[model samples]
Target: MKASIALQILPLSHSADRLQVIEKVIAYLQKQPVNQVVTPFETVLEGEWEELMLILKTAIELAGSEADNIFANVKINYGQILSIEEKIEKYHS
Candidate 1:
């Protein structure tokens, strides 16, 4: 893979809307052409570097618009990266 991005978005919003906002972000990511693994805290995306960055930016923007503010953490491994399958394939059921 060209890169992998692990994104966690924390949106400051009403408790009622917080989960909805997060769902929107994940929905957007799911539409992209990438390998994805979603966890309780973050989502890991593996694909081309540019595509991943753009997807990350758009997901953050989508979250920010529905909340008071957005705090996001993005971890990127460029040039050389391990895909989600490569990291956890053996553990799959």
Candidate 2:
């Protein structure tokens, strides 16, 4: 894995069923190959850069198809850094 991406997807639907769209997106991401951590506001993914990018792109497309408007905020770190597990190990008992 050469990079990590923190992806935050916010889907706005014309109807009040926005949560359903968000949940569907999350479910799709969870099935991907990269290591993923789902937080309250964002999902952290660790893996090859290209693979991560694909996941991000697909996520946006999927959510946008289901919702009226979808916003994907991505934070990327290049080069090899500590794995997600390393960063949170201290907080996890």
Candidate 3:
């Protein structure tokens, strides 16, 4: 089944630049198969749950590698597509 994954990543160190970290994430994702699903920098992605999880994990790792002193906070929210559709319909009414 397909799912939507939303990731909010923040760097742990105050010295770490936010824009640089975001850029590294975008660049890293661009080189991966996951980029085929959508533009690499998109905050939201729709795909198989397992694939999405793997991509997110890989992205976090890449981000960490770009800055060894950097740390990340990640949150993964999962929902079945039917629930999303129902919510969309409810909001449209």
Candidate 4:
């Protein structure tokens, strides 16, 4: 089954520039095999839960490396497409 997740990442220190950090994140996501990952904006990632988690983890790691003062605020929500709602409901139940 495929699900969508949303993430919000922000850098933490005053000395850390937001634009530069965002740029690094954009570059990293662009290189991934998954073609639709978005950055500096809301993104809806479609993949298995485990695969999405790995992608998120990698994003955090890459962002962290860009600056010592960097930090990420991530929020993820999971839901299947309407066509698969029945399957999702069955899994949840």
* TM-score leader: 2
> Number of clashing residue pairs in every model?
0, 0, 0, 0
How does model 4 fare in lDDT? 0.65
Kindly list the per-residue Cα lDDT of model 4 for residues 1-93, writing each as its tens digit. Answer: 565566566777576787788777767666765525464564445567677788888878877876677656665546645433443468767
Clashing pairs in 2: none
When sorted by TM-score, best at the front, the candidate numbers are: 2, 1, 4, 3
Clashing pairs in 3: none
Of candidate 2, the 10-residue stretch with the lowest lDDT total is 9-18
Alpha carbon lDDT at 23, candidate 4 = 77
Query: Candidate order by lDDT, highest to lowest?
Result: 2, 1, 4, 3
Task: Flag the better candidate by TM-score, 1 or 3.
Answer: 1
Worst 10 residues of 3 by lDDT: 33-42
User: Against the correct fold, how does model 3 do in TM-score?
Assistant: 0.59
TM-score of each: 0.90, 0.91, 0.59, 0.65
Q: Name the regions of candidate 1 deviating beyond 4 angstroms.
A: none
Error of 1 at 93 (Å): 5.1
lDDT of each: 0.87, 0.87, 0.61, 0.65
TM-score head-to-head 3 vs 4, winner = 4
